[model samples]
Target: MVKKWLCAVLVSWWCLCLWAAGAEHAGEKPLNWHENAFFGLHFDLHPNAGDTELGRETTAEHIREMLEKVKPDFVQYDCKGHPGYTGYPTKVGAPSPGIINDALKIWREVTREMGIPLSIHYSGVWDSRVLEEHPEWARMDPHGNRHPNYVSLLSPYPTERMIPQLLEVVREYDIDGMWIDGDCWAALPDWSPACQAEFTRRTGIAEIPKKAGDPHWEEWLAFHRTLFKEYVARYVAAVKAEKPSCLVTSNWSFTVRMPEAMDVPLDYISGDYDPSFGAERAMVEGRFIASRRVPWDLMTWSFLKTGDQPWTFKNAAHLSQEVSTVMAQGGAVFIYDTPQRSGRLNSWHMDVLAEVARFCRERQPWCHRTETVPQIAVLHSESTWYTRNDPLFNFGGANQPMEGALFALLESGWSVDLLNETALAERAGQYPVIVIPEVTRLPEAFRQAMAEYVEGGGRLLISGGEAAEMFGELAGITFA
Candidate 1:
């Protein structure tokens, strides 16, 4: 009897070890330059109004069908401000009445079954209907207009209310990550009571700056950046406390300095989705930023063809070009879909996605493995855009100079392209030398890529106003 029991125990232990090994083999690491991509739907799932079957469960099943069909690596199921409207049945707090669909639960099941990580898209300073119910939680301007539906980081109450709910959903649904939005809506130094008090404490200044360009505006902006960094740090701590491995990221302003702020504890950072309006140089700078971290997540919009806007269909090719370039640089590419009012995929948009997915799959392995080799790389600085936006600068219409600069590179006899850090991993070796012009920020991934490039007998030329500030010491160059 003893010998039989010993043999059974040995068999059980062996099986357990085999199972653990299998799980590890199946699990994929966070994205790097060569293997990063995400198929995301920002407003993918909405609750059914009537006679409709587009609730969370149905949507999850639908998504699962597509995932099964496509078998892509990543998917971002965003909720925007409608978190409470459609998701697992919440007894504690509900966003709106008569809503019944657990979007998180459905995504959790589907992604987990398919071995994919699910990311929740949360708004940083915007709530759809929470402001109406809780007036104290609302963000107020100098005139006390209540700002309707917008909320700012100035108030800690919203974080107190919303972060817990977010944590609850993640714990219950076993989610893998979060994407924070609304961080760039307003400039920092808001006059909210909490913000004012904190500003006074930090700067020892009793009075608030009134105009947009006060002498203290730079200080005020720094305060806002500090405030967000602290809040993000706290939020990241909270997320890790529960899941221990969940990713936390913010949709940073188009240009953000990633390496300088490494102490700010975010798993990763992403830029906005509208590449059409943004500079391709910014896109290339973004690639440099993504190369700083393990999994570089970059957001790009899909074909947003509505009834009136038919030209958007052609833009799909542009999106494909940009997204494919980013993926090749080793960043996980997220393709966004702006849903129709009916909450179903538009037929034309669907066709575009089908082609995009098909093309990506054909070269999927290459995208995940290639590195960037470029002749010129441009820098993207939010401060430059902010300055350009100021009417006093005489830079013409806001965002015009920056817009013009983006197009001029390609037309000015350069093989212009935008590459993210992840993209750099797969193709960085291809270029013997590169140029970074007009950018003011350096992300860690780009920093590492440059270091490796230069160490391997590559020459880099960094020019422009902000470029000197970001890479002065690193590149051994001085712009006089």
Candidate 2:
């Protein structure tokens, strides 16, 4: 009787799969690439540096030399703020005098010649000029103090002003991609007039929470995420409209809760840094590599104390794990060096990267694909992750407090990606089991989808925060 029941269940599942696939419309977008990839070495443009300045042709040439030497599959060009910007020979925004001669073309020509795709990095969070030029665009903290290096998503400038300049640069230069840094949309302050107005409009409540977990919080929090998602959609659209093949993603480290919304418009997604620093960081990084629908890139050296300043972590295990994780994910690994800040590339760092490069080359077939038979799908939602923004409810870490827990799983042999809820809705059936480590504030749409999947037989594990309440609310069921 049990065998008969099992067979019947299998048949039902097979039928559902067929139906879902057939349900797609002719104009519906196709599935995206799930592969391991590369992000280029990141060296910030310094005005006064050793034979290199921001926007200088020499810098691009030097970068090209490094790429030729490293033979990386992709590379990123840093566009420093103010006079140091490296985007292109732009008329909208003034690029550094360093490239006023012909450096921009050299950098562009070198990457194209090398056949390695180029990604440009920009600090979108804090622009001194933006603040100075447009005080209205600045986000004000509770104390009424404006923080440096932070941009208010509530400001319309990104879509109106910033994107056009970015497009002009891309179109003029024919660049292949973008990496947006300092995207603290989730952490944008509460005093923005735009946010206040939106909050009032959405929940009929004018008061914003002073902290993360205040009573009327989830609604406001949801708005913040919604705004960010829309911003991402717009940014991605601008790039793809100009160059459909161009890849683009913002830094999403701890901001995403459910699976990423792949349908939202992104060629790929990435994070600021990876924190796996021990022997086990490698496998966990590998798991992160495979967890995303698109290729993942690991940030290296950004978080470290530079050797030039002061070195931390004797072994360089952190750097090694960066490459390992990206390789494991069948994604790309990016190494960032901020002049004298991210320390000089020591022999140890170079050696680890070299080994990783060689390993990726050797395992090209397996390392270039997203994981199949994923043992776990970590439920990620921007709404839930913001719950940690509470000073009191402090879950853990700046990026993914659940990393330690996820690491435990990886150490015990598990792979995972911190995906947004939208991503979860579409791909829920792919995984047999999913673990929502402390997710709260579930989106109704994602909840309904998850409920159906689980009822049809999906195993779920959740911990910390309001995962229980959310599950109960969403599915009309609860799990401990």
Candidate 3:
């Protein structure tokens, strides 16, 4: 009973604030996302098999009102979610249940009429519906059982379903772009018969590594990463060929979570950040992405949430502080607003966004696609990270020692940028000091590179036990 009251009160308070800050936008239209757009908004209803009121309450007036007030440079609306169902009446894909009307059509029309660029939130790899419909396409676990959610990259899902759906949407609706989600982060190693045959074919290793510590584990892992990267590249190429102007990106593909050298042909790089307090996450992600030398944005969940608590909207001041961390490092800002099941804009939440927008715009002159003035250099090593990180993409909730190093630097008042092996290779000698944080496994090639840098008068700080032992050759004196 108390929980119900708290939820009701939070709703009332949110609505009140949104109503209070009902400011209108000027006559300026938003710039193209590929060109230069610092601020954006994303909404995904994530309709499942049980959704009963899809498109019931979404109207042009409500959408127009929200767009006019928020004035985002680009808007990513719901099309398909992890459940593998389209929100609208999709001819090429499965539409979610309880579609009273066309909600996606409404969003596209309203945004088009208002001149706001629109993109769809499309899920890749992690589609439950596809797994349910065709179990043969499912990934085979190491124990030879069918994995629950992901489809095999070697399967026909991409050609028959994923790519066709993407091409259909852009061909039919003419939306600006697509934001592919559930990719990379949801990827896992596949031990299917086809994958196994190919794995042996490519690596010349007859036996597959069951887990992380197997004899040829690194070779097995490297093979999987290459294949998954090919899967992403295939779809991106299809999208570009179909509609050359359409923007596309796979979430967390090149970010710190799966930090590789920027090898994929992404028009722009982006990831919607995790919902924990958000300020800390923005700082770490912003610093790494800034070093990638591309246009990127870090998203914030405008509401605070943890465990099973109700989603409560964060105040503008708190949101601003989070955005400041990203913008200061020259990263674009995107806010995710959880949509009501009824498909209507909650005016109260718009009020919070209005205030946050003002704060970001005020500091736009000094930030947005700017470079960090390079002070302290920290290596977020891809080779060292992938060496032992058994999981394909996500670290499975492990706290990063590299992040802790960055925090220590911040507390001691030094400007820092988190860089991958590729970025550091380009400008290694620019920074005075390079700190390698607690890396247990580093390639011999990188070790030689670091030794050369140190020999050339570069100051190297090797943190943690294994790193100290490995880099001890540079101490220039023997310890007792």
Candidate 4:
């Protein structure tokens, strides 16, 4: 039977996010991320150290032209990226070489004048600059070698650099907020002396595990994960305390990729799905965020992964398909684009953006803030994924069985919501059918809950060897 339910439509078309470089709104009241900020444009270059002539050609006319044509809800411009270089010159942060013009000023002026919320894409945890300069702050790998890209949480990088730069941009540009990238996904397990010392104090585990198979391996991973969570909470709190109105979100913090409950003080939740399987990735990410209690959106890469192309811009129809996938899943959508080295958008790029804008606006009235009517609850087990995978968040890692299961149900045309142990515990009987897909292990509490739910006549569907063995008797399935 194809699981189905009524789709409750809440129609409030959001503004276009025409972010040529920086940018929001149609209604009399200004739209923000909390409510009406729907369609968006994300333009980034991931600022590098060797970059020169940054924003030299990003004139007022070019930004205004693109904004007028697309008229997005909010515009997110590149501020700081993985390289730890700032696009705009700042008194506090490491500025890129040869930044001639005040591009951030121009973007803020135009966006503010046009009454649109202009946010920034700032790289948080991963900083090559920080790693090179402060070798002591680097996250040490199990082999005693400091990471070449990531920073250690036990170090003062967050306090000394990350938070200061955030506050600096907030106060300097008077910008809307920041979409923090390279954060949760960029976190590496810190095995540095400082981290190990602190981990020992907290957990009383004197012997630190050097590898995943060593003694107290789970404890070591859990300890690092806890520290990363603290790092996020601290920075978010600091930013909000400094600018209470500014929105803050780390890309993919509490999404399906993390398989954890929403605990951070994130103003919104988001993640940029890898373009390799762009459509399929959105199918999982979009639905998971839509099920979240906070405001959320998914960013789509504007181009496909062509080996030679730096960023090969996809045609309007191709991008529109990705946008439609996100819109149909009941969350706002943003299309990611890379501008020229001079920070100017070429006409070729504009042509595709304008066409994509038309497509997104056309569907705005119907799919804006669409809510999922949950019919099938696909359990995304935190224990299962964490035990199998190494990182805290696995966006581009192995395709957990949950992905295949969700994809199968979706292809079969069932309305599904991906839920984890925390979510299911609160509402075990909510979904009409609960499907446990091939998990190596499940919490005993969940097993008891599922058994009780089945005893009370709720449908339970178990698949895969491990999952089937766990609930084989409950499912009344016998294997020879």
Candidate 5:
């Protein structure tokens, strides 16, 4: 009887030690700003031909008025947009036409005084100036002609001109950070002499494929992926070297377009949710970003503009609904707004933001840093998306399958997490079930991890024909 009692006491003591250690570890984890409910504003201002001195002054006044009405944690103002035009006087890039004063400087001064963090919206990898000045820096097409739209990261423009200009904003203006736009949207496979030589050097293939399905097409795709990854990493490193506290993120860096970009040392992850499909996209992307365990936010358009139509402010009720959906999935909220050419913000927009801010602020207690109780996890393979048509592996194109799975699970009222392979390998055991939806190919390491997860009594639900054919035996079934 004494021996059994002593053993019980030892077991209880051991469990208590583990529990104490876990509590200490949890306490040591630092809190991120994104872990809380953050309300921010994104303003994209591109002056047109008619913008005059009166417009600039009025706009500046309205900016102060708007801030007073709707206080935000952060505001992202335009520095340089897609047209490679700066709203401020810039030595490194072209200034927008008809800009009489430095709008960025005014915004910096105002936001700083207001005690709000300021970020700039700068377009990267797609500068129209390079198209005109150095067309060779543009991405090359199969016809050996430069694309009129995008600049290649392989060019010296990003390192020499772009990074320098970005650092200039941080140093000269004392800005908080940069929300880099047009990175994923502008990245394209290049067939330039440099790319061709590098491909040959890496793969030992002298001839490069001209189009999809040609010889070595897969190798070409893989090469571009690696190129962009390295390109982003280098730029991020450069920015940190200059200003370690300067938050830098390429738009859509960690979303469906370039999940591998998470490997880059970015301060945070964010994407502008499509206005048309804002709710659905936010639900999926929020889970994806949250799984990375980094700070993330989703930007939604304040107005719903369709196909060259004039912009109109979204109703407060609609905006509130959209914000709630994102916050519920553990994402902060940023609303995108385009100011009038006169530089004045609409009072209606301010009222709308005020209402939405109130909604978010009220829910801070329950919503901020609240852990998501995940019931299901859907595996999203970045490799499958990147190498979709290689003929070497079976995988579907784009994120349609993953989206379909999310929709179905949500419709059935199940809480789901959209996990990348890395997240799944690490935390697959936490959830009750793992779902592989339409992912035809998975890396060997991920495959082994999934097998072990299932063998250890975890449940799995796999859909899609190709996935069934591959993982059928592991799930205790055969296709015959």
Candidate 6:
């Protein structure tokens, strides 16, 4: 009996060891060129109605010229845009009425000749054609009316149409990857019958909230957030299942817009920074993406607008500055440009991009794979951003004290990283100082993690009355 018990225990121990080894291997992935300083171009090709004749030969010549001049490692040309029009001839979906030639095919062939990887900018959730063809796929509002703008992922269109179309492009084109646009950031609370039924089935909450202030509003928003996240995961899995080597990512997947989305299996993370906000936002976004241990690049628009009008091309000096901020935080850079409706390249824009590329090339060695020694970490509560819609506390609050705190820290020349609750809990001890930044509502686990961090001799710089009230003792302050 004793010998048999010992044999059983040894077998169990050996099985546990094998399970651990397998778990570790599951998390490992091979690094690619995207991990280095990749200078890329994102060409937007949404032409106006009158500009239908997209001179294929001229466009190819322009692409060749641009490639020769700019020398980008990768180029993301438009396959589909927010308007839900395909740049290439398609049997599945609506091709742009204005496009006379298959521009995507042309670009793919040219980029292949140039020995550069080509990625497609395909709109995911915010597709207009899906909404127009199947109104049932549109996100329904409180009034039972469909939103004309974006498609609901909870509907059947994503599985039936979106994923299949993505696979179609991958199988047909000689493309490297896909940068899926308008995913999590464009998600809305869907009250469609399918969504409601699924929500009720999952949560057992029979009553659905109609408005923001209604009971269970927070729960409803949380459900929708998870729904969009799951949708992205499904799309990524579907694409990879078809083409395992095909890299895939949704815009703003790991950025401030949807930090939790970093958990999704993406080849990389990227987003176009608002040129109006300048380099400050880039710096903030870069640090956030870096924390996720993934390759990331932030794109800057070529033209900066004054109000509703496009004023002028952002010069090389301005662009170089933006690139500097991204690189400083250990990220690559991509400059965004819009091609003319007639499929002509702007020589002057090519010159500007060349100059920017030269700047990145010179600094690539120091910037690539460099580690950021974070001195401070600011908590960016994704939960707070999702559930709470108060103008003073939510997205409209200008990010409130969080932005203010980050700005002050940047001005003071302090290296900062924005961490969500999960990251904060896991990495709280790594930072010498952690800032709460006026957050009122926080999970108990995160609060306890901070407390333990402080007890372990980590410094805490917390702002706001609510935070002060909760952690006053740790900061050696008495609250009334």
> What TM-score does each of the candidates earn?
0.70, 0.71, 0.90, 0.90, 0.88, 0.89
User: What lDDT does each candidate get?
Assistant: 0.56, 0.57, 0.81, 0.80, 0.76, 0.78
Give the per-residue lDDT digits (tens) of candidate 1, residues 1-480.
Answer: 434533553464345435544544667333221123444444444322231333423465566555554444556664544332433454444443433454556667767655665777666655645665566666666665576556666664446656776688677876667777765443334578887788889999877776676767666656766766776677777876666556777666323332232556666657555545433534554454554544455666664444566646445567677676566555556666644433334556556666776677777666654554456544333444444343211223543433445456657865444344444444566765455556545566676777778788877666666766666667676767
lDDT of 2 by residue, 131-204 (tens): 55567777777667665545677786687657877797687777667777655433454567777887788789
Runs of candidate 5 with Cα error greater than 4 angstroms are 1-37, 47-55, 58-61, 307-310, 389-397
lDDT of 6 by residue, 1-480 (tens): 434533553464345435534644575342343654378999877532344666444467778877778778778988878878777776787777777777788888887666566889988888887678788889888789998868877788788888888888988895778999877667788889988999899999999998877888777877887787788889889886665556788888767766453667888889888867669778778877887778888899888887888668988999999889888877888998887765667889999999999999998888865767879999887766654443111255636567788889989999888888898899998999999887777888888999999889999988888778878777788855
Q: How close is candidate 4 to the true structure, as a TM-score?
A: 0.90
> What lDDT score goes with residue 302 in model 4?
82
lDDT of 3 by residue, 1-480 (tens): 434533554464345324323321232322234556778889998878898998889999888777667667778999889999888777767888878878888888877665566889999998888888888898888899997789899988899889999998897787878999999988888899999999999989998889877989888778888888999999989987766557889988888877787777887888877676689988888899888888788889888778989878888887898889999998889899978887987898887897888789888888988887778899898877786564787765333778889999999999999987767766878888888998877778778878888888888888887788888767653445
> RMSD per prediction, one decimal?
8.8, 11.1, 8.6, 7.0, 10.7, 10.7
Q: Which runs in model 4 stand beyond 4 Å of their true positions?
A: 1-32, 307-310, 395-398, 477-480
lDDT of 5 by residue, 2-77 (tens): 3453355446434543553465456542222233328899988753334454136544566777876776777898
Clashing pairs in 5: 59-343
TM-score of 2: 0.71
Q: Candidate 4 overall Cα lDDT vs. reference?
A: 0.80
TM-score, cand. 1 vs. native: 0.70
**Candidate 3 backbone overlaps, count:** 1
Backbone clashes, each candidate: 36, 25, 1, 9, 1, 0
